[model samples]
Target: MQTASRRFDLSVQYACNKEGLPSRPQFRGWARAALEGGGQVTIRLVEAEEGQELNREYRGKDYATNVLSFPYDTEPRVFGDLVICPDVVAREAAEQGKSLEAHYAHLVVHGMLHLQGWDHEEDDSAEAMEQREREILASLGYPDPYA
Candidate 1:
């Protein structure tokens, strides 16, 4: 539970260096958009092993997906952490024919929205969240992820 004013703070790490990770400013820009009024967040980039471990331990998924959102507080100066797996992101980007940076931006925005009380558990909620994500991603100059 940390807090900061209208600013995006990110700390990135790598469990491996197979894929080139996004820059700090790139992450800040993406997260800032999702914050609405801006806020502080930590973006941790890991390899597949750590990502899989986190997903398994916390989400009960045996394999790693993409981004994992961990929000701490939101009342005053929204705070949260985003765990991103570079391996999975790169793979997905290649499979989906998207640039690495674009995928990272999408995930960062998606995670930030989740931090601020967004969910995709139900069809309605999922559609709403995806639309929001689409708008944000589009604004960030990325094509629709679902398309």
Candidate 2:
């Protein structure tokens, strides 16, 4: 398969104490699977505090989510930023009985899809978005995350 020539900027902002999470290469793999052409994206790996703060500030939710997408208003090729909470992701993986790596891959793909204009606000939209996610994840050697 031909990989797209894209540029992704991953910024890991640790607001909480954690270590040994997946690196930028792993995230780039997921982003490439979702987006095409040459463009940029920022991936911020934050802690619960910052994640919760951002969620509350922007999304009106007081809790930290696994991943939050902040797509920039630019060319469609130049996606945007994705803030990922490692603590939340780990907790969710343990609670959901999923491997950390697999969960991380799923969330990255999900966030990238959001940047690509995929939303899950409606049932049909969710189905289509999730199908795309599954296909992307499967290509990356991961099982269906929603299964």
Candidate 3:
């Protein structure tokens, strides 16, 4: 059931509890949907500690975020690494009353979108990004993460 429109390879590394994490195929689906199978992606699932450290180091934020995107090259095609914190993701999902799977899917797509130059730092950009996210998630049979 997992496939991509073009060449897609998802390299996944887990530094957290393996349970409840999506499979490689699932990630491939998300990445493919986000980039339309444009390029390669690497996703690393991390614990809260590492997530927090990375956030602080890279983003100047001391708290752990649900996901962070690092785009390496995007001219010819989208290529990047995404770091996802399962602890944060699970907490956010539970707090928001969303399914873990759906939240993860949303984050995967969100991260991929970021890699593709999508931004939400401003109101207009955020709205556009959210709309794209809703549409993409909908395509994947997931509820709107913003809704």
Off by over 4 Å in 3: 1-5
Output the lDDT of residue 140, model 2.
Answer: 90
Which ten contiguous residues of candidate 3 have the minimum total lDDT? 1-10
User: What pairs collide in candidate 2?
Assistant: none
Q: Which of 1 and 3 is the better model by lDDT?
A: 3
Clash list (residue pairs), candidate 1: none
Clashes of 3: 0
Instruction: State each model's CA lDDT, in order.
Output: 0.83, 0.83, 0.90
Candidate 3 residue-wise lDDT, 8-81, digit = tens: 67799988899868998898888788885468789999999999999999999999999999999886677899
Query: Per-residue lDDT of 1-147 in model 2, one digit per residue for the tens?
Result: 423445445554545554778876777787778775655788888878899999999999999999999988445465588898998999999999999999999998898888878899999999999999999999999999999
At residue 71, candidate 2 shows an lDDT of 86
Clashing pairs in 3: none
lDDT of 3: 0.90
Error of 2 at 111 (Å): 0.3
Name the better of 2 and 3 by TM-score.
3
Q: Lowest summed lDDT over 10 consecutive residues: which window, candidate 1?
A: 1-10
**How close is each model in CA RMSD to the real structure?**
3.0, 2.7, 2.7
